[model samples]
Target: MGLRTDPVIFSVSVALTVLFVGASIVFTAPVDALFGTMSAWIITNLGWFYILGVTTFLIFLVWICFSRYGRLRLGRDQDRPEYSRLTWFAMLFAAGIGTILMFWGVAEPISHFANPPQNNVEPQSVPAAQQAMGYTLYHFGLHTWTIFCLPALCFAYFVYRRGLPMRVSSIFHPFLGDRIHGPLGRAIDILAVLGTVFGVAVSLGLGTLQINSGLTALFGVEFSKPVQVLLIAVTTALATTSVALGLDRGIKRLSDLNIALAVGLLLFVLATGSTLYLVRGSIEMVGVYLNWLVPLAFWNDTFGDTGWQGDWTVFYWAWTITWAPFVGIFIARISRGRTIREFVLGVLGLPTAFTLVWFSVFGLSAFDIELNGPGGLVQTVVVEEDIPGALFAFLDNFPFASVVSAVSVLIVIIFFTTSADSAALVVDMLSSRTQEGTTPVRQRVFWAVTSGVVAATLITATGRSGLDALSEVVTVIGLPFFAMGFLMMVALLRSLNDDTVPEAVHHLPTLRVHLPRRRMPRIPRIPRPADGEPAPGSPRWIIPRPGGPGTERPGPERDHSE
Candidate 1:
């Protein structure tokens, strides 16, 4: 379980990331322009794919839940879940979308409210307000979770269920068999690493922006490149130290702290701000989201102006897809031993519910202040382009403004650390040749530092266009993995169908159960081997008896050549 580094992947990933960061810093203007143009090209041409592919993934996951294979466990039938339900849920919520929610919960609604999504809706009107909250919830809702669900489910099924290595390429085993260990598989793992590194680094950079803004708002500190770099360096060092300490002692504790602070922040806003409005608005928004979900989910903006769609909806889908590798693998790694049904429902439902509530509290609070209270805050956000300050601006209107604002800053820092450390673990797994346990401390530390340095370098080099470059990089880089997402879903279904575990049979109403005197119980028969004996490593059929004391007892094993 010591450091078993895969030299090819580990070196190549680090070298490429360092080189890109160096080039971007040395050639700032050209690199910025290059990323901007490339991003535009991808969004303009293939934005539709990002939209439809994500929608398809959501639909595919739903089908899996209701299908016969839903009862299949991610691990062996006798194996119970590793982490308890509460810890598992908490960890997933924190690592999954905590940072994004911290970054955008306040700003996005205000941005949308100031400029409504549709052409006809008057900006800042009552309808605009409703739609703004609705759209915010929509963006962070089930759609985003589905992006994590598909890959997580696939990876879990392959690794825990089939006894394969915990690698993205393992998802192809149903299709490629042992070829999963070949060049194609290694290529897939490399792509996963690419997504993980870029996505995590960009997130680290973006979170730094929010933290920088928090400092400027609270302490009157001047925002500068040096300051931003310093923040990244400090936080990255903390994150790296946590990673070196390992998952149980480090990341889990950080995640728990994040969730606790997040809850405190949410409650303060709800109590200080409009409690009744936030509550009513949340209920109504949930209804509105459900009503509009189908149309919104499938809407690609083909007929009218596609600009807004590309900027907001399409960009969001791309961001989630880009982050899916890190988030998915992180979720999968922590979610071993849970049943498929439990995993799907918990991952998709709980986080989404939390997102909706959190967004409604913060987003609606800002909207209320804009509509009725002192209105300069929304203007500050819109006219001044001070998104990083939006949360602080909102907090300014509440009681104990300074205290809450400082707490918000702390929440952001913790969220940033949790996201970075979790991503480091995922990247370490993807790059390492080790079969199990956490990646070695050395590999984890290398990735952690590399991620932070890359982020700070890119931000320093590109200036205002730093985010645009990150966006485009993720959108473009996510395409190949996006395609793999679909294939992984297919492979999951195939593997589940052929699995030795019998599909759970729903017995139709029978007369035998009604008359018990002399009735022989109807035994559910198992399918026989297709030819002779079952293949080596394949599970043997186990016939289930009706009304038996031990219904799950194993039956005779059929030889493959029988």
Candidate 2:
């Protein structure tokens, strides 16, 4: 069959993306300056919104997890999980934050330690160390995952439970109803497309820069835009091949590999580094994180006037929001049949736990080198500003530096490829008219190549400044989606309140109550409905009937429940 593409979404998104790339290439300086200015303005004015908005999402997700809705599955009551728990966690973790953790696990902590965001702590002191780990965890912990969780929950609930297409606009169906297929819906999807494109491109650009830095450390390769562009080309090609293999055979396997390799690396560092210190530090880190999470979540640097919150915390939140469309949809696709509780806890807990350990190992090891052993991380990362090379430099102080560094490089490459391939799949799904089967290989290839082109263009047009510009651009692009997040929560809550309990669930065995031998009044039973008709007082949307709102075909059966 031919590709089932949405002409409006696909054509318009492609045209706009092409225009952006061409304009950036032709007017690189002006575009960079404009993005920078806009980003700065956002940080100064809307920083509070990002902080408060994300905190509200976290609170909302927690409430949903423990509330009555927690028992509700993303699919039908008879449906069960598609992948094993291990594979499910692996896929979500890899696609969500693998590359980013690798990039920032070491660099961020050290930077924070050297220059704590708060002025009360002395730089490079013990207080600074505690502050560093606390703030790092704040950035990468519960709040970050909550951003992904909100959108994913909305998407999965609508698509699998309500039988809607797997598009961002589908989440707004309760508000828009059939208008989800109208101009407004198309506009929403297009915005999602643009956000996904640029978000993935920014990540691709970061991966390219880091990969180049790895090459420079290993083989003395010149760290320049030309080389980075070439690296993007090579990895995008690999991603294209993976995209063609489809999710099960390609993304799934890569995700499994990513987790395995990452675990191996984590164990290696734990063994080779100061094990006792790392363990003790990790426990303390968790304590500090829990103690300060509330304050940290609300702290917007209002009185401090340091601008550090905007530069780091707000920036990270915006970056994650930019990623919400792509990551959320990918997560929703793989998250069928899980309960809202399981989905929320798994998405918010597992990867976050791993991230804490990952950062603690790398961060504490670097701290050991700086505080007790030799000191070089401060100079390399904070002073010289070689953020990408910080990981390799930290490894240099360990045994078999080259081997571990090479493994790190390979890991980055695979992370880059997996992200690119998964993004291509999601973008194609969003832009497609049909959501029944595997997307056309040619369409997936088009998006994969398009992402590569965008990354390469950003690198070529402004060099290192391009990465900074992309960060700013992502911050601005993320604002709309951040606002959309609030609407999604409202829509989802409204839909859930009106939802009916599944028939199968009601029929399940229940506990019987023993009573004393006394006369009891008999209660009348409710009347049942005729065949093809909804039960009395029940929502009509529960039953699939002719010429009804529930006439849409049920989603495909991937559930393996008995």
Q: What would the per-residue lDDT of candidate 2 be over residues 148-174, giving only the tens digit for each residue? A: 999999999999999999999999998
Error of 2 at 515 (Å): 35
Candidate 1, overall lDDT?
Answer: 0.83
Whole-model Cα lDDT per candidate? 0.83, 0.91
Over 4 Å off, model 2: 500-562
Worst 10 residues of 2 by lDDT: 498-507
Pull out the clashing pairs in model 1.
532-560, 533-559, 533-560, 533-561, 533-562, 534-559, 534-560
C-alpha lDDT of residue 473 in model 1: 79
Q: Name the 10 consecutive residues with the lowest summed lDDT in model 1.
A: 500-509
How do the predictions measure up, each by TM-score?
Answer: 0.87, 0.88
Q: Provide the lDDT at 202 for model 1.
A: 80
**Segments of candidate 1 deviating more than 4 angstroms:** 1-3, 500-562
Residue 407 in model 2: shift from native, Å? 0.4
Residue 353 in model 1: shift from native, Å?
0.4
